[model samples]
Target: MTDNALAYRRSHAFRTAVTDIGGHQRFTRAYRPQTNGKAERFNRTLAEEWAYAQPFTNSHERTAALPGFLHNYNHHRAHSALNGQPPITRLNNFAGH
Candidate 1:
């Protein structure tokens, strides 16, 4: 699956990875937001809660902070749909314990 980012959509590396993985080349609907609803929602949450929560002087600082934000989001934040478990817990198959 791919987002609408121009760089991601057009990058040689991204295309090569998808092809190597046996994925077909298809584009998400241009104007239909529902086509990628899950990703859209995640992007919204990330932007509101992490990306735009504070002012960064430059892109470098924001990029540097992304790993910490992702780590915390995956390991600390609880999801109601996941029965209050962290994403990493589910991904690592340790949610029930």
Candidate 2:
């Protein structure tokens, strides 16, 4: 989901791209602050923990590291908001877990 930005809400190209990828854009609710705040926090954490955690020799190296980083982030890293549990712990009856 995106914030209530005019570019995301009004840009024809953006909408077309989302549709082309079999997805659609949804905006955060204006009345619920936490929805947007959570997304912003995740972005900050992703940048801090993965994107800038180390120097890569090249873009390819960084790109190659993303899957591992995401696995660790979602399945291993403890989040304060989740009561010190990893994100995966919050799932209810996950298919294979």
Candidate 3:
């Protein structure tokens, strides 16, 4: 309803999808990537390592491979900030620890 909310609805697929699934919509200010710094960094890493490291033969092949890359990134890769734990592990025990 606000300008920022309308902007989010127009811009981001994940936000739009979540809203469609009965989630409430809110908006963070523009130019405030620090608010979601971890996700922003992960996205940069994904783009650098997986998406644009080399030329994809086609868009379909790139799209098809993204889930596997994401799975490995979340489940296997150690993050220094997490004290060397993978994201999946951290997520599973997030509140407990």
Candidate 4:
């Protein structure tokens, strides 16, 4: 996915990686907050629920906790947007169907 960032446009490696994977980079339109609303909300939720949820002595410690937080968010925590189901639950249901 593409954002309105100059670094992404400047990086040839990033372009190559996405193209090689047969995934096209899609950019949100300027002045369209709705287009990226879900991503913005997810970021806020990550920060509030994990990154700033506790005090950390060092950056490494905070970063180390990210994987666990991600796992819980994806597999355990329920999301109202997905009808009160976790992301993994939705994915499993879809796969079964």
- lDDT tens digits by residue: candidate 1, 2-97: 557798777898888778956666666767777778667778878987789899999899888887888777788888868997777866566553
Query: What tens-digit string does per-residue lDDT give for candidate 4 at 1-97?
Result: 4466787778889888879957687776777888677667877898899889999899999989988998889888889988988888766455522
lDDT of 4 at 95: 58
lDDT of 3 by residue, 1-97 (tens): 2224455667778577767856666554566666456556766898997899778999998888887887777788788988988777756465533
Query: Worst lDDT window (10 residues) for model 3?
Result: 1-10
Which candidate leads in TM-score? 2
| Residue pairs of candidate 2 with colliding backbone atoms | none
lDDT of each: 0.77, 0.84, 0.71, 0.80
Runs of candidate 4 with Cα error greater than 4 angstroms are 12-32, 92-97
Best first by lDDT, ranked: 2, 4, 1, 3
What are the TM-scores, per candidate, against the unseen true structure? 0.63, 0.69, 0.62, 0.68
Error of 2 at 49 (Å): 0.8
TM-score, predicted candidate 2 vs. hidden true structure: 0.69
Q: What is the lDDT of candidate 1?
A: 0.77
**Model 1 bad stretches (over 4 Å):** 1-10, 15-35, 92-97
